[model samples]
Target: MSVDLETVKRVARLARIAVTTEDAERMTGELNAILGFVEQLDEVDVSGVDPMTSVIPMVMRKRQDAVTDGNKAADIVANAPAAEENFFLVPKVIE
Candidate 1:
């Protein structure tokens, strides 16, 4: 679960990044620190917590699932070169 100097160099090469020796050494320590923090997070107890979409307690906002024509056909075709009956008229591509 730790990032080493060799791993850093290998990852940089795989990502097509030019990592100088000095940059790779620096990144090795930085990446190890990040992994260490993530490992610490795994120690927390969350068995009682309910999964939620947001941190704030609130019900999910919802809308009716009724289906209908969006009523925006005319607006959608307003900028077309030729629009008829709220439909875009395109040139025939094949004979």
Candidate 2:
């Protein structure tokens, strides 16, 4: 799981990152350690374990679906730079 300097340089290039020689050497060691930990995780056994969303289970809250316009047209159009016929006016861009 050792990452060489060349591999690190290639990774940096692929990621569009500029790296100095010193930083490349440091990153190679850090990346190798991370890969080693991932390799170690591969040795663990977790057969038949069910995936879980959370440790504690609870029902989600539900609400009734109601549709109604809460009249706020005056408040909404108050800050417009230009408004006509109760609607914001803008420069026409399409023919």
Candidate 3:
């Protein structure tokens, strides 16, 4: 689809951007060029092309999905300036 200055202006407004007339014109030209390139790509033949994630096949490493008790609450709390009852203590803000 072709993008004109008016269309660019509408898009800028919808995106809550403050676009000057010069920027709107520039963006319109850029969007039109992008669409033109996409139209060019549409002419290529890819009927029997295989879908690929990468150029080379990869073997992903696997790991067991399990949970264990960390049991280091005192060690972790030692770093804090002030802690109470397994929680961080901060100054009260509300009246």
In terms of lDDT, which candidate is strongest?
Answer: 1
Off by over 4 Å in 2: 58-95
Candidates sorted by lDDT, best first: 1, 3, 2
Question: What clash count goes with each model?
Answer: 0, 0, 0
Q: Estimate each model's TM-score.
A: 0.61, 0.56, 0.59
Candidate 3's residue-wise lDDT over 1-95, tens digit each?
89988999999999999999999999988999999999999999999988776789876668887785467777878888899865788889999
User: For model 2, how many clashes?
Assistant: 0
User: lDDT for model 2, on a 0 to 1 scale?
Assistant: 0.88
Off by over 4 Å in 1: 61-95
- Give the 10-residue window scoring lowest on summed lDDT in candidate 2: 66-75
Model 1 agreement with the true structure over 6-76: per-residue lDDT tens digits? 99999999999999999999999999899999999999999998999998889998999999779888789
lDDT string, candidate 2, 64-88, tens digits: 7887555877678889999876689
Between the candidate structures 1 and 2, which one is better when assessed by lDDT?
1
